[model samples]
Target chain A: MKAKILYIEDNEQNLYLVTFILEKHGYEVCAATDGQEGIDMAARILPDLILLDIQLPRMDGYAVARHLRTNPNLATVPIVAVTSYAMAGDRDKALEAGCSGYIEKPINPDTFIQQVEQSLTKQEE
Target chain B: MIACLVKACMPPNITHLMGFFISLIRSASAYPFRNLSLFVVLILLCFEVPPARAEVRTVTVGVYENAPKVFTSETGKPSGIFIDIIEHIAKSERWKLRYVSGTWSEGLDRLAKGEIDLMPDVAYTADREKIFLFHKIPVLTVWSQVYARKGSRIQSILDLNGKRVAALDKTIQLETFTRLTNSFGLKIILVPVPDYKTEFTMIASGKADAGLTNRLYGLMYARKSGLEDTPVMFDPAPFYFAAGKNVSGKLPEIIDRHLSEMKINPQSVYYAAMKRWTSEEVQFKLPLWLQMLGLGLGVALVMSLAGGLILKYQVNARTGELKLINQEMEQRIDERTQALQVTNSKLQVALENLAVAKEHAEAADRMKSAFLATMSHELRTPLNSIIGFTGILLQGLGGAINEEQAKQLKMVKNSANHLLSLISDILDISKIESGQLSVFFESFNLKDSIFKVVQSVRPLAENKGLFLSVEVADDVEEFTGDVRRVEQILLNLLSNAVKFTQKGGVRVKCQRNAGNYVTSVTDSGIGINGKDIGGLFEPFHQIDTGLSRNYEGTGLGLSISKKLVELMDGTLQVDSSPGKGSTFTFTLPNVIDSV
Candidate 1:
């Protein structure tokens, strides 16, 4: 079965761009526009990997990562931090806040699909 | 008859003696010579009769006072060594003694005016010598001395410089002290104390530095007061009794003889009187120390009451001072408190104004974001149509058009492309303000991405008839960074160079900038003015907006480029001068090395 990917992003255009790249790689994509909904959707769908945006409404990507880590059912799921904040130490902050991997936003169509596949495969192993 | 008369003139006793003497001479010379001898004897006897006795003349002696040596004293009456000698002369030469009594000045004045015959015990000073015939006898030697403070340094008349010496009002000692002190150039303040005792007290109490008194008086005072002897005596001149210049002729002779005789008696009455007066045998009994202590305590109690009154005044003064200080402190506190309240109110007003400003800022932000979304959709839709249709047409989808028509179509396509870029820049700025813009990162070949940017802008450079060159430095084969943002920054710079320059070439260079790769685009274009360089990266800031009208793009390119560079953790810098072209550079960290 194709690996299920959950994408959390607030910007509609960015979400369209990311989903277009992920679907083209034969991955089933579930999108949540907010961080809390992303965590709830991740639990329900039991996605193989979650691509979470750091800046979102109501809940942020770090909070979602922490929420997913706390739930026994979703504890093992791999979460990737996707953000536009490319300042120094952002990656370490994301990782320290419970994301397994980090990605910058404005998705590169080819590279986005490859990175998501790599994260999902690594989770399975 | 002559012989009988001669015999009658002589006494019967003499005639009998003469007859016996005649019988003796007649026996020798015979009867003839015997008659002549008897006649000569009778003649010598008549001439030898004794003269009748004259009565004794009585000389009158007068004296004002029984002067010790010159007058005698008997039972407190005037009878002394002087009187005894004077009575002996009076008995020998027959003189009467007359006694008188008066004050010393009165007696001296009477003697000087010739009212009295003589005055004894007078010192014959030069002034007194002018009016009096003085006897040579100096019956007593009185020395002048200065009785000073105990352990005083004063020793002689010269040492009396700048010192206050006290003396009696009118006495022989006063004249002597003044004359001697004046001769020595000493400043003597002759204080007339009541007596010698008081004068000693003046010196001891420091009222006077020293006292000028007779040596005898000073010694007597010192002995009586039990004071230390600070005798400063010198220049012993003699004291003698003076008689009037026109006295009774024998009066001076009588005084002279009396004085001469009195000198023979060594223990004279004057010495006895002085010894009696100055004797230490009659000591005065003083009150006991306990009695003096009691009197001192009484005085101290009176002084303590006065001290208590002064202390009350001091306490009142201190209380007044403290009250003044407290009032001043309160005034200062009030002023500071008022100032603080005013500052607090001003801050409150400032905070309220800041809140209002923040609300407006947020609203403006929301409106900008909404407008950006609508504008983005509107602009991109038309741009897509234009670019899509032009692509088809240029690809010969409508059958090959003429070169002129194709060139025109391409021009239209470029204009549409520029408009789309302008709209995109605006949208990006709005998105950045609303915090919706995001950066994308990927592992990519840095050289490949730079080459692609050069290739894309090369067409425009060719269209502008300007040479465009890309020189990638050695050892920079691959780097991990955001390719899309770097491409955008490079394209904006290159496009501006192409748009502004009429002829000169444009060059793109990449070099290592510390830990980052610095990419610069230098253009020999119609260069930006030096003054406008700072505004170059601000949105809607164009040099001469009217000149920018000829250029077909909104002035948001550099601003959007700067924002995009910042989002990728880089710096965008520009260097330019008026008419000297421009260099736009930016730094991008090599992603692999950055981590």
Candidate 2:
């Protein structure tokens, strides 16, 4: 079965690019426009992996991470935080709030899929 | 026996005794001790029995048994201390002397009654002066002191606190002892004796536990009276001879005359008598051997100590000069060292502050890099899709783009690549400023790197319709340096050459000079003015502010290229003639090999 991924991103272009690429790689993708929608969709879908965007409207990625961690249904879902704001300590912040993996944006079309797979593998281990 | 005398002599506190008797009668069982005390008081009131008087003379003198001063001596002659003093006065004045012995109180009574002409050894008090004429000067010094029988337990004044303590009647000691015991809250029996001699005798015979007498007589006549040494001495009294106030006599004048004479003339009989009685105290003649030893040791000790002190003084004076000089030099050294330490600490603080400033600058530089990266990413994220999708369309992946659409897609791709290059230049400058741009050096073909750079820049020149060429010296091919940065330098110059030139050509030439490979780029375009040439190598500066919109750039190419050349241990320079031509030149050192 194709690994389903939930991408919680506020930017439409970023979401389109990520979703199009992820779909091209044969993974079922569910997109959310904001952090709350992402958390809501994540609980319902129970996707295999979640690509949480740190810069989001209404709620940020860490908040989404903690909310996702609370739901028993999404306990096994691996969260990978994607951030475009390249400040210091952004990765540690995302990881501290229950993100199993971290990736920086603008995401490389070449390695984004492999990085997601690797984070999924890491969560499995 | 002594306790009974003690009770008898103490003028019993009649009121306290009455209270005790009342309490005793109430008890009705303690009548024995009460009757005994009553009997003792009666005996003390009536027991004293005698009266004695003397005949008259030129100066009838009354002498009390004040022992050692006016007492019956061992020979029983009419002699005592005052008698001898009077004999000296009588001899001087050609007057006959008369002396008599009596108790102190009896003598005072007789003198007051004008029976005696003068009484000696009387302590002058304000109360006594009303009855007698006291002399201004004292004849002798006396002490009221406690004396005890040989081997008796009454050895000290405190021991006589509850014992019978005898003091001469009408003496200073009597009043003193009364006040002292009252002040001390001592329930002691104080006996008023007629004289010190009898007081001493009573103590010696154990009729009294302890009695006070003149300290000198207690010491002088102690062994004779079978008593031990005086234990407590107090209230030093000055005794003066007093004349009867009732008699208007020349006695005071005569007495003062002889007393003053005796004081001035040590050879007088008074001095002889004092010397005779107090001979035991005269130890002016020490043993001969001890005197000799003391003199020898004293002289030797003083001489050696003086010699040592003089030598030490001379040595200290000699060393003090050297010490002063050394102290001055050492002070100068210490001052200089302190100044140097201050400067060193200041420099250390400056260094620490510089390190902090450097850290802050580095942080700003990092932010700039991140800014550039984000800008590059943001600028490229759109470009990524534009260029990638365009490339895809041009490749006919979008199901056959027509030739016109393909041309537009290609143009879009090229613009995006240009934008990417500009972003990279900004990133590179940020890296150099932040000290993050690392150089990798290796032995590589210098000509090949330049050739590749030229080939890559050929399209920009061709697009501008400017001819570009490369020239290389055969010996300057292989060089040890960061070949990539060298190529980047060459590319920046070549691109600038093509970008600026409108109707002319660009050329690159390489040659070897002094272990360095020099590269130069020449352009025949709208050249920079000499004034503008200096600023041309600075990032984001342009000479053509004419609004002609002629050349396009972020103006970072030359600055980035200049820094890259410097990073490879090279120099970048330019020479330009306005509106005519320009040439950019740089050199990369061929790093030497240690192996």
Candidate 3:
């Protein structure tokens, strides 16, 4: 069975590219425009993994992660943070805020799924 | 002297006196009028009556401050040893002595104007004799001396030239000083003090460099003022009583007779004055250390003890040696400083030369690295993509292609691979030229390395339909070297053998040669010329022939292989002949395993 991933990104072109590359690599991609909607989708569908964005409207990724963690069904989902900013503490902040993994953006279509699948692999183990 | 006179003139001596007068008159009668006139004048002078009863012959004595000889007494009278002599003359000649006081030069002025009848203690020179009539007998023999600060080095009259000297303004030594200056053309400045004491004081206090005065007065004052004596006589002159040049009376002849009488009697006032004034004690300027030793002792005794013998034995030798040692030390310091400067400059030049060589080597390395970097990026980028995409296409990911099309594609891939190797060879040449080539030492399977190179080159051999083979000696498997570079060297030689041999077989042989691994590649092909063999392993050199154009390459294979082998601490060589087969051989050092 194909592993499913939840992608949270505000940029439309970035969302389309990651979705296209994931679909091409035979993985299912579900996405949201910002942090709150991403949390709602993660709770409702409880996708195989959540790919979160750090900067979003009304609620940031950290607050969204808190809101998502309150839903019992989404607790074990591997939350991967996909970020465009390469600030020094961003990776540790994402992991601390309940992300299973971190990916710096301008995402390469080639290694993008391998990184996402690595997070998904952790959930199975 | 008075007793002698009384004895000569008393009645017991009356006939004797008459006898002497008759002889004097007899000589006068024989000489006629001129002799009689001189005899009458002589008799009048010789037999003058006592001034206590007869008409007084008042003689004005001109006096001045000249210390022991002619200065005024503490009682304010014109009295000194010279005055005592004159008083004796007054009592004998029945003349009343009147005293006039002034400086010594002023005494001469007063005498010249006839204001005083007698000026006592004059240093008689021909110049002074023109102004006054000096007595026939001198009262004193005198010379001038210089007194100085204890450390001053004035020992000669010549040493005083251009020096500041002290002198009494009106004294006889001032006259002597002036005469000496004019005679020797000296340019000394004389600082005139009022009395002889201060003349020596000015030198002791450092106000003047030297002082000039009578030796007797200077000696007394030099002790009082802590001054040193130079013992250099300024000049000597006979000191005499002088009479007025205008005087034309019996007074002068009377005074001369009394002086003659007084000199003959030891009991005379003249002899008493000589005993009172003459010291005969002289002192020289002792060196400072000795003078310090004489601080409380009698200066006269110290001077007598220290005059010549003791000083000569001690001072000259020590001073000469000190001066010599000082000169030697100064010369050594100057020589050492000059030598140090020369060596310092030489070291500076050496440092500069090393810096220049280092800069040249560094700049060459930078240029080589920059050229290699650009080639790696710009040239390899397109070639990599072209080769990679071609590989993907031949894998049929897009679609299938016809055999003819695939053959053309295969040719493109082969040519691309060849071009890549040619570029790599050029880059390697630059690296070696700039001394930037690096190699690693490692141990690996030597036979496996050879067989790998053989496998890679076998298809090229098959394309030419040439038999290719390898023989590795039983003991030649594991070795030590930079494995990748060694492999590259083997591949270069194998590729060249396959490319050059068209009809005959190519063979690679590897063996252990007495602890070293030697590899040789032999080929049956159009062989190199014997003359061309020398240049075969130099970069960018190829032999020209009818078949040369048919081959396409940078002609860099054997050269890069040779240099790469050398970089691995090995040697590569070629043996060939025109139209005969050739062999390329190389030897690599082995890591000897311990038992």
Tell me, by lDDT, which candidate is best: 2
lDDT of 2 by residue, A1-76 (tens): 8898999987777777778777767899999999888888998888999999887777888899999999999887
Q: For candidate 2, what is the TM-score?
A: 0.39
| Listed models, DockQ each | 0.02, 0.06, 0.03
Better of 2 and 3 by lDDT: 2
User: Which residue ranges in model 2 land beyond 4 Å of their true spot?
Assistant: A1-125, B1-364, B367-382, B395-403, B442-449, B474-483, B530-535, B543-549, B591-595
Maximum-TM-score candidate: 1
Q: Note the Cα lDDT for every prediction shown.
A: 0.70, 0.75, 0.75
Two-way lDDT contest, 1 vs 3, winner: 3
User: What's the candidate order when arranged by decreasing lDDT?
Assistant: 2, 3, 1
Write one digit per residue (lDDT tens) for candidate 2, span B314-390. 98997998899999999999999999999999999999999999999888877888777677557756655665455
Candidate 1 CAPRI-style tier: incorrect
Candidate 3 CAPRI level: incorrect
Q: Write the per-residue lDDT of candidate 3 for residues A1-125, one digit (tens) a residue.
A: 89878888776656766676677667888989987788778877779988777767778887777777778898888887776433325566777777778775444433566788788888899
Residue pairs that clash (backbone atoms under 3 angstroms), model 2:
none
